[model samples]
Target: MIPEELLLKYTAETKRFQKDEIIFSEKQTAHYYYQIVSGVVKMNNFNDDGKEFIQGVFYKNQSFGEPPLFIDVKYPANAVAISDSTVLALSKSNLFKLLQDNPETHLKITQSLAKRLYYKAIIASEISSQEPAHRVLRFIDYLKDDVYKVEGKYSFKVAYTRQQMADILGLRVETVIRVIKSLEKKGDVKISKRKVYR
Candidate 1:
């Protein structure tokens, strides 16, 4: 991710968005490079039958929707705030110049996008071949791996709700609930005071 000082230098302002607010819609022209300053955001899309699919969730200090900005293409998915959120939005042109001036920051962006692509590849096979419980465990394990990279720790609270997990994994909310309880029973996951840890 780019540094906050550098992002603000390009945007000149921070904007607030409420929960469930659409930040951008699918097929819209990509115009801004966004970084979440506070709260959560989800990149998602709907299928032809109106089923919702979550591409990814981002937290504070995380950036989303970068590929379109770099390639000058329409957004393929919508971004929406999952909670009351503040975001810094940099103009695409300004962001490009910032990247040009800072090769290290550009490298960070490249690595970030590559990481997401790797996650997508794993998830594609998981969803296509795994059972609900298997898929759910794989998802949590994937997140655990990411946390391990950052903190060198194994346990972390899940940032998403059951419904959100269901949406992302192409399962029913009931299925997610059942799988979570099953995981708890199997000692694969721990749910303490309603917060999940793995």
Candidate 2:
């Protein structure tokens, strides 16, 4: 984890949010770089038809809001708390000052940006080159790795609803349900309320 002193030097404020609370709206000015200290945050994009699509989900210890901050643009998506969450907020000026003061931190930030770009590339490739089922499978695989624990049986707690899952995978709700059913039929996964066993 990044050192607390470094974070404190850059951060100007801190905020807490409850589950399902909106952190920011699409087109909102990017004033601060936010770091999640605990819980989860979901970033989503909406279409003109009022359909929402999830862009990404951030877990504990993750940072966001940098891209738009660097670009000096409005936030491209809306961000919401998936659970009770706390975030460190660094204003744009503070971020710039930190980067200027710590060259090493600037390098680290650049590397982080590069990694994010790579992930976006991977997602784009998967969307164009892989079948919808395979894309969903890949997403499931990611969730399994990120959120599950394995013992005698695989069990996981999901942070989002089925509809949210569908949005995250860029699939229709029916298609998401179908894939879940398929996984259940194959004995690869079992859903019990909010828990999934695989």
Candidate 3:
């Protein structure tokens, strides 16, 4: 859990955003590191052909903007809210101040960074050898083990859309849809009204 003082400081600078609202644009200077207090945010990049690719989805309690904070650079991707969201923003200077005042906080951030690196490695390994369907299955397993729960045949509180899932898995949207449908046919999973059950 984050420290209460840190939470208070963040709450003071936090703001609310509605669905589809652009939180920040690509190449924009990263002045603030944000922690999601509620809802979801998607980070994406667009190629020269204007084809958009999602980089990641950040859900509640997740922290982002670390790349910019560490490099003292602009954001490499744009961030947009996928639903009504409330995010706590801490300026670079303020964050540094907090870290300076609390060495433990800095260590905690380092641990978080290490965990992210480990997860990234796993994602790369899985995407390299798995078929699209298997990729989706592995992703679901990760979600179940790391993010949420699977009770009987139902999974609850999934925070990603099909497109976002495709982006994370490095698969095309149509491929994702087809793989999901195939899983449904196999009785491995089910999709109803955009909710997936396994």
Tens-digit lDDT track for model 3 on 8-121? 674438789999999999899988878899999888988788777887788888887677888888898999998999988887788778888888988988887776676678
How far residue 132's Cα lies from its native spot in candidate 2, in Å, is 2.5
Per-candidate Cα lDDT values, in order, are 0.88, 0.77, 0.80
lDDT string, candidate 1, 164-187, tens digits: 899999999999999999999988
The most accurate candidate by TM-score is 1
**Error in Å for residue 76 of model 1:** 0.7
Candidate 3 residue pairs in clash (backbone atoms < 3 Å): none
Q: Residue 4 of candidate 2: its Cα lDDT?
A: 50
Q: Return the clash pairs for model 2, or none.
A: none
Tell me the lDDT of candidate 1.
0.88
Worst 10-residue lDDT window for candidate 2 reads 146-155
Q: Which prediction has more favorable TM-score, 1 or 2?
A: 1
Residue 42 of model 2, lDDT score: 89
